[model samples]
Each structure stands twice: as C-alpha cells, then as structure tokens.
Target: MEDMDAGRAGTARRWLDKLRGLIDPERMGDDFLYLLYHDALARRLGTCHDQRDNLYLRRFERPQIELFDLMAGHLPVLTLAGRIGGALLADHLAGRDTATLLSVGIGSGGQEAAVLTALAKRGRAPGRLTVIGVDPAVGSLHQAERAIRDTGVTLDFHHVPRFAERMTDQDWDLVRRAPRPLVMNAAFALHHLRDTASGADERNTFLSKLRDAEPDVVVLCEPDSDHHRVALPERFHNSWRHFHAVFRLIDVLDVSAADRNAMKLFFRREVVDIVGTADDEDRYERHEPAETWLARLREAGFRPMPAPAESVSEPMPPAFVRHDPDSVRIGFDGESILAVIHAVPAHA
Candidate 1:
C-alpha cells in the first residue's frame, strides 16, 4: 500500500510539473504564444473537456463531485466553501415552515443535496421543500433532479430547462407556484452569464430580475478569480495565478494518473475559454473574484448578511491559504478563490 501510494504521488507530481512547465507565464512570455502552447499541450495530453456533451459530464463532472465530497472533510477549500454556504442556507431557512430553493446551474445536484442534508439535520425540514433548478443543459437538470429525488427528501422539484439569464414567464410562473419565501442558490453557475461583452451588464440584469422576484436570500458559491475580464492579457495573468494554485493542490492528492489528468483537462478548458475566445458568444467559463460578485449583488439590490454563528474558518491545508479570512471570505494563494457569500434582498 505504501509503495503504491508513493507511486501515485510521484506520478501526480510529474503531471503537475509538466502542467506547471507549460503554464509558466514568464517562460512563455507572450500571451498569444502561451495560448498556442497551452492548446497544443491540451491536445497532446488528451485533456480537452467539452461542456456541450453529456458523456463529458457523466465521465468527468459526475465522478469529480464524488472526489470533491471525499476531499471535503480532508482539506479541499472549494468544497469547504460549499459546506459553509449550505450551513448559512440552513440557518436562513431554519424557522420557516416552507421555503423555495432555486439552484442555478444545479450540476448533478451536489449542492442541492448538501443543502437538503443540512436542512434535514437542523430539524427545520420545510413542509414542502420546493427545489427549482435552472440550467441550460437539459441533461444536467435531469441528472440533478434524479440525484436529489433519490435523496428521499420530501420536496417538489421543478426543473427549468433553460438558462437562468433567459428565464421566461413560464419559468417564473413555476417558481411563483412554489411556497415562499424564496431562496436563490447559485453554485459555480452564475459566471457563465458572461455571454456578452458587458458581463457586468448581463450579471446586473440577471440579479435585477432575481431581486424583482424577491428571493429572501441569495447564496453564491463561485470561483474567486478575475477571468471574467474581456482583456486577454489580464485574463491570462489572472487565470495563471488561479490555476497555479489549483494545480499545486492537485499535486499533493493521492489519486490515479487518469483522475488527475481528467481534472487537469476539466480545468484546462477554463484556460482555453479565457485565452482562446475573442467573441463573447464563444466564452462560457468566465469567473470573477468575490468582490465583483459583492458589487453586483449590491447594485442589483441585495445586501450581505452576517455569516452564520456556525461559520468558522478552518486551518487551510498547507500551500493553499492565499488570502486572510476575516468574517466571510476565504483565500488561496493571496487570491480569494472560494467564498460562501450570503446576501438578502436590500428592501427586505
């Protein structure tokens, strides 16, 4: 067992070193050249992740969630943010008899499952837990709906097979039919709203619509990076910093070469989107830092709520603590990468 573990670690290290060598901005010098090199490495390494395909999600995204859950208790910061976010949501819904949870980008329903578990444990199980999941991918929604239903949580789940930004009256009508107060939960999904040159405009518009809908609280768990910027140079630099930290984290994990490579490909797609696309329509994986989200939430008529009493920062795993945590923010490598932000409608 010990020898096998060492072998896995060594293989992971080599993969990390290779990826680092390819991603070294100083060595690459030119952003365009770096993009070209990155693309070639992706092809050669067989790490290309296409989001449009169902097979990709089943083969990569679904199994990745299992890995995420396993790492959550050990040290993974991204999954840690999710635990904190779910706790906050549970606290918000504690005393309510019935509340709606609108999970945007409910990929495979992991976050929803986590939130449901939290609520059940709190003894605040709503009389009717109406879960409305909105996603552009119908296949993902079906998987999420099934995943949550299998959890045996008594709830009415409505899947809106459409993009959250493009939600129409039919979707809203479904949401309206749910018992209130409504809670909007977005996990790693809102960043995809950057389908236009003005991501801020699109973000604000979506938040405005949500605000008008009067959700009691909005829980946001997203990557705290600045890859949402339109400028390729800035995007490249910011992405390098964010992904450098991720690769460093993956290097230490005792996993198979194939698993590590799949993760590499999954994240590499983000690099491709940021550096490869000039047109907004071609981009789908835009991410912004926590501060950007805070600003947008405020502009869209939401105010930050206090972190729950149970919310406490843990000793970050070695080499991953990048920024200091005050009350609500957690950083990795001086960048606030994972955050569990709780905000309520300003008027409420």
Candidate 2:
C-alpha cells in the first residue's frame, strides 16, 4: 500500500510539473500559480474527485447541488450576475398585465424565482404569468418546477425536458403559442450547445429560433472567456486566465475551507472539458467571449438593447462592472468574467 501511494503521488507531481511548464510565466502571475498548485494537489490527494463526465448530467446530485448553491450564494460573480439578470428580467416584466418567460437551462429555477420575487415585491408581477423552462436534465426541470412553485406566485409553469439545441417543433410550438409579452432568459446557459466541424451551427440556429419566436426581450448572461477554440494551447491559456480569476474570487469568500474547496472542485469538471476534450464535437463547456455572442445575436436578427443602469452603477469590492452600449460586464482583477446582454427583435 505504501509503494502504491508513493507511485500515485509521484505521478501526480509529474502531471503538475508538466502543466506548470505549459503555461507561460508571463501569462500567469504568482497568485495564479499558487492557486493552480493547490488545485492540482487537492485533486491528486482525492480531496476532490477527478473523474470526468457530462457536467449537466450531475446538476441535481446532492453534492454538486450543494457546492453550486454555495458558490451562487458567496461567489461575487455568480451572486452579482444572478442579481443583475433578475433585475433585467424584472425591468422588462414591469407594468405588464400578462407575460411569459421562457428560460433556457433553468437549472433549479434559482434566477427565475428571484425574478418572480422581485416583481412581487414591487407590485409589478403580471396578473397572469407563464414560465416555460427548457433543459435536458429531468431532475433539474423538476427542481425548477418546485422552486418556482415555492415562490408563492400564482402562475403557469411548463417544462420541456430537451436540450435547447434538440427542441422539437412541438416543443417550440409550446413556446410560440404561449402568452404574449414573452421575455427569454438564458443565464450561464447556451454555452453547452455543441458546435461541430460539420457546421451544425447549433448555437446560432437556436438563437435564430428564439428570434423567430418574437420574444419582447431576451436576456443572456454568460462567461466572458473564449474556451471554444479547438486548439489546445490557446484554449488552455484562456481557461487558465479565466479560472484563475474565478479561483481568486472563491478564495476570498467567507465560507469554510471545506465548502470553498468543494466549490472549487465543482469547477474541475469544466476545466477538464476545456482542456481534455480533444474532439471539439464532444466538448460541452464551449464558452465564448461577449463579442462573439453579440455578433451571433445580431446575425440572428436581434437588436441589442442598452444595459440596465443598476448593473453598472455600483461596483462591488474586488468586482467591477461596466456597460457598453449593449451589454453589462462584470469582472475581477482586470479580467471580464461575465457579461449580461439584453436584446429585442430587430423590428421590435
């Protein structure tokens, strides 16, 4: 047993050293190096599981769910993004007698619930509100249903257990036939839509479908990194820079070390997908920069809308927010971590 342990430790050390050598010293600062060292050490020591699998499939597992909630509650990027998304959705829903919200990848309905709660507080909730949640994970759909119902708001809830890219016409008919004043929200989602060499164009195709649905407003919150490149070296450099900032934010949280470590562990699956998936068709965490999404939205015939004022007015400590003419972005240490974009149909 001692010999086996030693062998494993040696292998782990060698892997870490190889990873360190790949990263350019000028590209990664000392703090990032320290964070990477600890992350690699923890995974090797079995403090965090290293097995790779479909990240969405594990969405409802108790451990992953708990870690997700921990990060959502304490991590400044997630907390602020959720808040900003909810605010943006609420802004569109204000003063409507009836409205429909079609949320893609509505995992656990946390952001939707917050939007409903905010509307209720402001006495601006629609008399008849319908929520349609689309996600491939059945467990996540169930959880979202429960969470939205628990919001104590009387509204219609519908679930389409299908990937946004795989939604059948019947499923879209449900969305198309839903009540008017429709507002679409995709938060930290859409990145999972796979793009292949065959040029399936799943992401853009889905966006075009959304545009055809003629939603009054569409809100998209996504990471501002470009991990979608097929080249390993470029993808690795981007992933390292993006996640370095994320780990830094996690380090400053007031949570216990155990919880913090677990939260970081949750991201390991993402990192693995970004760097380990040699086949671009099989990779799921294909995050792109804000500019890419903006261009896609425009190509899909959607016009970008100005970001809400509140999104950029107050700067959270260690997290700064800026608004371009079209999108609001949140970042840490000079890296743009996340972006929230609002858009409407070109004719609207």
Candidate 3:
C-alpha cells in the first residue's frame, strides 16, 4: 500500500512538472517542436489565441483531452491494441522474443510507456519493444526517458538528430532497411504537416519505405476532429484558433479570477504570425487541416485502427470556471475525437 501511494505521489509530481515545463517556453527548446511551431506562429505574425470562441477552445483542447482520455481513461484499449499488434507482428517476423517495437512520437513517454509497461507486467509485452522514439525535440525525449525509467523494457531514445524533413536520404534508407516484424507507432504528430507538398517531400517517402520494411504493425493516433487523415486547409494560417481552445478551458474551468484577459494576452501578444498567411495581417486564424492528413496516411500505406472507448476510473474534474458551458472540450470546443491508424506489411 505504501508503495502504491508513493507511486501515485510521484506521478502527480511528474504531471505538475511537465505542465510547468510546457507552459514555460524557455525549457521547451527544440525538443517540443510541436509547441515550437505554435510559438513561431504566435511570434512571426503577432497573432493571438483569443479564448472567447467556444469552438476554438473545443478544437484546441481536443488533442489534450484525447491524450488525457486514452492515457488516463482508456488504458486497456491501448494496452490490448499495442500488445496484440506488437505480439502478432513480432511473432510473425522477428521469431518470437527477438522482435523490436518502435514508438514514433514518444511525447513525454508517460502515456504510452505506462500502458505498454502495464501490459508487460501482465506478461504480455511483445517480444522486445525496442521502443525507439524519434523526434528533433531532445527535451521531450529526455523527460520521457527519465520518467519511464527501467521498466525491464528495452527503450532506445533516438534524438532523431534533426527533424524528419531534414533527415538525409541515407538515414531514411537505413530505416527502410530495418528488420521486419516491428511495431512503428506515431501519435498526435501527424497533423503538423503544412501541406501535402511537405509530407510528399520526405515523410511520405519515408513512410512508403517503412511500408516496404514490412513492420507487422504501424499505428497512428491523432485528434478525431473531422480532420483526421485530411489535409488542413490554407485557413489554418489565419490564426492560432487551436491553441486558444485550451486557454478557454483553463479560464472557464480552472482559473480562480477567470482572468480571461490573460488568455487574450497570450494569443495576441504571444501567438505567432505567419507573414504570407491570412491572419498574418494579424497572425491568428491559420489552422491546420485534417484532410491532407488522410491522403498522406493512405499514401503511406496505412489504414485506420478504430480505437475503442473506455471510461476513466476517477476522471479529472472538468475545469468549470475556465470552461464555456457551451464549449464542448478542454482542447477544442467540443468532445475530443481520437483516430488511431494501424498498418501491416502488404504481404502479411
């Protein structure tokens, strides 16, 4: 019982620390490339993440809630899915116990690793989850590695040396030549592509190679917004609507003073402003589309994996003060939608 209590306390500290790190731009550096892009958008044009729009908050909070929901509420879903997929693929290709699984977007590592480790505890860990996290963001990976600790699972943290696009063809070639029977998982990282052109350039090509590598399972998880697998329209360049969605949640559900003005300050003063984009006149509305995402995923030879819904044991209390009753979500403006995609070697 004492051990369990200690574990809980440690988890709480980690969460608080991560949140502080996320809100603090300085610590993020290149490790949080996602946040970096958002921050750039805010600074480049002088756009603002206005928290007034209920729908905006809905979309903004959508990803956060999805991460929270899957990680916090629906643990078994990920466990079962990853375990089964990992096992099947590894067994078929890597010769039972010798296969290595890869996690593309490790994030803070807490969520996926927690689920995976829980599966491992049950003796269901697939072969050897090599658990390779690839990202240009060193900070997130470093934090994740420390947080995950030694769970008896083999975790290989690859700094990615550089962002995907910057990766040399030789590096991609090496990935292409990787062994069969591996699990490659990417989550919440797909929607960042500026356009199909961006994806087609390197990521799509690399994904095509992975398809050839015949990893038993390739999984992708992203916001369930109607945008999944779709191309984000040029409209996203207009403003930082996505970021503000969460801000509204903070103000409506959590903030004591309901300091709505701070929300505005962050958006207007802190958000990025893309010069050539629409909101660049103000730098605010430019939102990423979900359509191009679909086309790209398909192009990469992946199909959607329907994620089952599971309820939380003790769900976190909704941020009522920061919430807009009319608002639908903590991230976006409504209920969060998560899309997980799974793929296997064409032959297998």
Using all chains and alpha carbons, the TM-scores for the candidates as numbered come to 0.75, 0.82, 0.52
Better of 1 and 2 by TM-score: 2
The total number of steric clashes, by the backbone 3 Å criterion, in model 2 comes to 0
lDDT of 1: 0.66
> Can you write out model 2's per-residue Cα lDDT over 4-72, one digit (the tens) per residue?
135565665556555544644234433334444434344434445323212322432347667777777
Q: Write the per-residue lDDT of candidate 1 for residues 134-164, one digit (tens) a residue.
A: 9888888888888777665777888788877
What stretches of model 2 exceed 4 Å from their correct place?
1-62, 312-314
Candidate topping TM-score: 2
The residue-by-residue lDDT of candidate 3 on 278-348, one tens digit each, is 23223322223334445665677765333222212223434211111111122224533233345454454
lDDT of each: 0.66, 0.76, 0.43
Pairs that collide in candidate 1 are: 322-332, 322-333, 322-334
Give the runs in model 3 whose Cα sits over 4 Å from its true position: 1-96, 105-108, 138-149, 155-159, 173-180, 193-200, 223-288, 309-338, 344-348
lDDT of 1 at 130: 84
